[model samples]
Target: MAAPYLPMSQEEMKKLKWDQCDFIIVSGDAYVDHPSFSGAIIGRVLENEGFRIGIISQPDWRNTKDFKKLGRPYLGWLITAGNIDSMVNHYTAAKKKRSNDAYTAGGKSGRRPDRATLVYAQRCREAYKEPPIIIGGIEASLRRFAHYDYWDDKVRRSILIDAKADLLVYGMGEKTIIALAHELQERRAREEKEQSFAIDLQGLCYVTDTVATLQPQEVITLPSYEEVKESKVAYAKAFRLQEQEQNPYNGKILLQQHQDLFLVQNRPSLPLTTKELDAIYALPFARQPHPSYANQGGVPALEEVEFSLAAQRGCFGGCSFCALTFHQGRIIQSRSDESLVEEAKELVQAPSFKGYIHDVGGPTANFRQQACKKQAKAGACRHRHCLFPEPCKNLEINHDHYLQLLRKLRQIKGVKKVFIRSGLRYDYLMADKKERRRRFLEEICQHHVSGQLKVAPEHASPKVLQYMGKPSIKVYEDFKKEYEETNRKLDKKQYLVPYLMSSHPGATLHEAIEMAEKIRDWKYMPEQVQDFIPTPGSLSTCIYYTGIEPRTMEPVTVPRTPKEKALQRALLQFRKPENYELVYQALCSAERQDLIGPGSKKLISPPMSQKFKNRKLFSDKEGRGKGKGKKRRH
Candidate 1:
């Protein structure tokens, strides 16, 4: 029989007729027992392995009272800053406090403290010092190495050191966590001290006192923490080295010095096989926020994913701004079609499932398979990208499996519509054979699209796009024309919504203005714009801090000041009245004052003055019609 939601309290544990939990997961988000949320997946996975699991979600960090709610676990404490990094969750790219946190029950802010993994780990230790604390999730995964912290504006040491965690798991940690669990269980069975367990597990990072025990040829030593903290050049070098060794097949152990101790990261865990992935997703999940949140409004993050299916995991698109390469890795790991169909049928049985499947893709919707055959045997190429400046000749671009899966999903009884809300790599699509590409686009426009399809073109400037690891703007233009033509053929009035970003590391005012002009030509006013945020563990963030692209070590322009960033962002939405001044300043700064005028080709209209305005415009037209007895047309 499937399990109920993992016990969140001692009373729930007692109700289940248990004296203690084998492990307690402490997270910074509300406990939503859904596969989409990490806490639930970890808890359910452990439960499947016959371990008693309890969760303490968004515990108050001010004291150990909440952390001690579950009492001491037999295994240890698993820590995470929820689905997202706590700092990123709390603040915007501009360092402004966010008004609502979707992870929290009531969409309220300030539920989790800053650097939540660190704080949560500290509290867990304070609550019970004997058991080991293992940290994972986006926060720990990205910050496992010494990294540039955007919030601090300086290099921070590896999170494992700061959090004082015994071990840190990186990437999608299903396989790694299971390994750790079994090891801990064996140690407990043998009555061994947790600290005495020598953990050299893959996809894990730990601090050791010496490298003398490690084989010299099996390890790659990175720059010391002091070196990276003191020099941008060293930081870039360190980032470059770490990125190169990410391949699980050929990757070696990574070691870095943090003052007196050595922070060691084992090679990444192997990607899960299709059968393994299917089994993991098939694990029992209640697929709802814990009922305790009934009054406070359930976790807002679960809404989008409640009825959706995560078709696959990982991306090989290699966008410089994306963190998937670090977290989920570049290799694609997908579940079997049978598993997905079964899950979709389950959704149909739900009372609130309104005949719609919200989404059916992972990081990149169209990426249903590995980039090439070589990836399966040898792992992803360390030095080159599958899709970047140009699609690699070895790249295998196909959408037949995805199309078949979608067809099956939409045909499911009571599932009226199946949508593809996740990002679609148009460049990869365009690289496909003409007939297949046409068929896929036609089917998408005819069946999948809900009206507007959202895609990320990111920027219009070639230089900026290159820095972003995105294809040329011409690629997007080609794809856009093809998309529109496909919709026209199907007699559907569907449109494309292009996602644009502003103030990326390599973008100057010139590039920003160029993008603004492209937006003008497209007659599209984006409601929301993405400002390039320097999140940890991304190539773009490395350039944002070092002022040099790590790959080439060439200096790149970086927009660091708030004023400059504001100007760049304003240019992306120059049509807005609120952006007038900033847009004007940007135009002047670029020496393109011609773009600021009353002409149709101009980006913004010149500022209006009372002296130049027509007097009749300000006249009381309403009063003139009312008082003079002139009737207004209805």
Candidate 2:
């Protein structure tokens, strides 16, 4: 979740007594509301399969007493590799430097501190030393290998080497967790009868067999961190091989050296069915924030609703910088409007309800349903890649359903105002000139928009946008115009807050200057100028290093240095004289001699000499300069 959506205090936590957990699954993520709650869902799945379970709402894993309060599990503790490492991610920034696995920034990558795997492992070891601790999640799934730790700014081995967890379970945990629990309980009983009977903890790796045997678990040949740092592609391949084999925990075949980085070899991630999803929606949501925090500016403002709901899941848009397509796939699944309305109704009755429904959207909100029926009719297409190079051809462009849903939510009693705060694919919404669609948007704004709308254009340069697998700037302009015109007609003064990214791999200093010039023309200073973070499992990561798509094999020029990335980002907000000087100096240092003067067709730079180059951010040595002899006329 973004910083804007941080959780509230204790009092607010009380109003939303939404859950009466049978076995509190203490986790890093806020309970239930996380987009893809695979950890929580798997726990529930096991419970439904006749295993008892409860979730200990976010506990201070740093404290031993906290773990004790969780009490003894009816079965055992199921720890997980958090959905994403809690470390600050800059994968998007790395992608801006190269087109593939060729260049990774040294300082910006690593495992996040909030990752449940590390935090929970430490807590379990200290507090509940007896019941088994099982780890699984994104943190443990993808990087379960010897890889680099961006936070510490050094290369490190597998997570197991760091977390010291008893058992590291990988991939999905639905069937695996249930089996482990049953084995533990059964083993305890068998010991009483025979005094020597043991249980084999299947689908996991544990340090000790207190409930089973006294023998040591065998080891296997695993990739070293040095080997992985040398070649990420090879590491990905090595893990993929392990993932294909069955019986992940059978002796030495199991790779356990860096269990944290080791990709789970066996258990498959189970996709949820419609019924299963409905059950999740039906689960109680304790939407309360702590009260003391609320009064002392500790809770999220009243304008902020205690919880957010995901109306849909998965995105078909294969933006190179996004991980949704790889992790969740391009398929879009959704909850029915009836379910959403029910959830909204429940939200209103809460004691903390402010009457305003903050947001009801997910993964490009207006895409309340999947892509067109044509694609569904043909089944999953084998085109291998999206055609848009940005928004795939199969991306279903329909806002009619979404429009209806929003209108219904607004009509709910006690709901003061329903807003759509999630990112809206502006291009998708404006593709057709259908008067009905346009008018529907007009009405939605009149009813739902909270004075501002966020749409991501990413970059203005055609080449950069294309390289980013995004729609052209003209498409973004079209959407902006339509949005403005719609609001104008309704007398609603809301404005489109377009999201932009600087330092994408394809953007050159000149292109960046052009983007900066575009910002000046728009007369809008953005609140957040996003630096790209190229996360793992995204098409952009390959492009960040290789400068070409593996499938098409096209030639690309990646921006591969710190100075280039910094200059490009600064251009997005070049207002101060200092900013201009910094950008001008940066351009000169990069040997971009032609952009120094006031008469250039592009954005200009004031001249600075070689004496300033050593100064931080800007200096004379990197200053704008006249060409070696004469300025080349464009």
Candidate 3:
């Protein structure tokens, strides 16, 4: 009934009884028709509009052979670098090549090129130069501006220039893509070669040779590409200006010069209403990886999300390291409870249904509405965060709607458990009235948690927290205490897994040592410690490249070298035997040798081998004698 997964090949298209596809989507991910996959969602949305759509997933970029699989489309070609930025997907924070890609079949890597969007766009041009090329998704969205590229270690030009795409869609592109599709359809019917495609559409960017015709009042010009490329101060200023104009209601057009060409970005598209969001999720989705991938063990990325429900979209937490503000924007758009419950019924009927729904949430699971009433009309405040340095007094801290949705989901027939796996903004939760917060925590601990609830406190240093745009460690501590107390009353043996990070901007060795000390006091061994990766289009990445916080224009210490990053990361997990040497060195460097001894208060025990003992690892007079006048490494 749904044309069985959007005709990935000509044979499939023939089976659908369609002569030609209205649009073709090319993605770096394996074809997974689930709502969680962006390509699938776009394809289905187009199909729902009575337009025939085809998709080519993870095509061979070496030649035009694979790109020709879907043939040419009647409307245009939509290209994306899958769910992740291709560079981030291929490399680690240390720039080491990754061996596995969850979006690929059999968990293998190298299926897609390093910059998949750019590669795919070029191949599309090679195959058919007539069709208009459009680039979107996480890769193109974040790199839409001339910003930092960790892989290249330099500021790259806007992706629109590199990809040579006719139009670049930023943010969640459901509304923007639909509008473009209709406009293309109208142009095709008219046979109008003179009428150009609309460049004034919201959430779209285009390149032009001149800005002489543009109105000065409607456009705000950022520092030119050459200016930002040469000056860190100019780069910071450009990022600040871009962030300020992100609001859809009051935001103005942004223009940036690249050599002789100008990149014009229209204001963001408005957030979708509940009714609109509900219809999009309810669109007929096959809700699984294309049957072709069954033999290759399917796409690993879909495993966890197969039975999960997406209750909402967008986040307002404003973590500096996250690109949600750049992609999904700050306003929250949620689906109706009836829609979620109906989807749950369908999941229960699947043959692989396990009686458990793995997750039921969005970017921030508990965030189900706009931050405040004003956000609906005025859009999110441009210069301030809702719950960062401190929760705004006007911030609406309510979890009632989310609780109702979860309750309704758990009540569905044949459903065993409904877990909230998405990250919960504990600061926002803690800001709620005590009774409501307690009730929400109690319900989650009693019914939703699957033995462990993962919350991201990120770091413990106040300086790093401020740079990260996160609440103080005190907020996390209060939430942790309340959570433990709630589990105690419920007599559940659940634990809190705090997501920790290291080597973020503003984190010197001293701050790293401070975090290690806190971990020591809490007696928590972080199983995983994320070393900050400076992916494109995040405030933290901008600061990493410029050494200046865009918001304050103040310099911050950045852990850029491999040695410093390693030492800082080791400090978070000092208990690991493999990290003993690095932790000892960090302790000595931070003048925190007090933490490397054989006591319960110490973070790690002194090295047992003579090799480390013979080195002058400490600067203090007491440990100087142990080295026997050997030169100190520090």
Which lDDT values do the candidates have, in the order given? Answer: 0.90, 0.56, 0.90
What TM-score quantifies how close candidate 3 is to the native fold? 0.96
Model 1: per-residue Cα lDDT over 1-634, one tens digit each:
4457888888998889888888999999999999999999888888888888999999989999999998898889999999999999999998999999999998999999999999999999999999899999999999999999999999999999999999999998988899899989988989986476446777889999988989999999999999999999999999999999998888989999999999999999899999999998999898888888989977899998998899899999999999889989999999989999999999999999999998999999999999999989788998999997789999988899899999999999999999989999999999999999999999999999999999999999999999999999899999999999998898999999999999998899999999999998998899999999999999999999999999999999998877677889889988877666567667877999899677678987665654322122112332111122221111
TM-scores of the candidates are 0.95, 0.71, 0.96
Pairs of residues at least 3 apart in sequence or in different chains that clash in candidate 3: none
- Report the lDDT tens digits of candidate 3 across residue range 1-634: 5787888888998888888888999999998988999999989988888889999999989999998887788889999999999999999998999999999999999999999999999999999988899999999999988988998999899999999999999998999999999999999999976537888889999999988888899899999899999999999999999999998998989999999999999999889998999899899888888888889987899998999999889999999999889899999998889989999999999999989999998999999888999999999998888997899999998888888888898888899999989999999999999999988999999999999999999999999999999899999999999999999999999999999999999999999999988998888999999989999989999999999999889998898877788889889988877677677788887888788777788887666667765454344443212332322221
Off by over 4 Å in 1: 609-634
- State the local distance difference test value for candidate 3: 0.90
| Better TM-score candidate (2, 3) | 3
Clashes of each: 0, 71, 0
How would the candidate models be sorted by TM-score, starting from the highest? 3, 1, 2
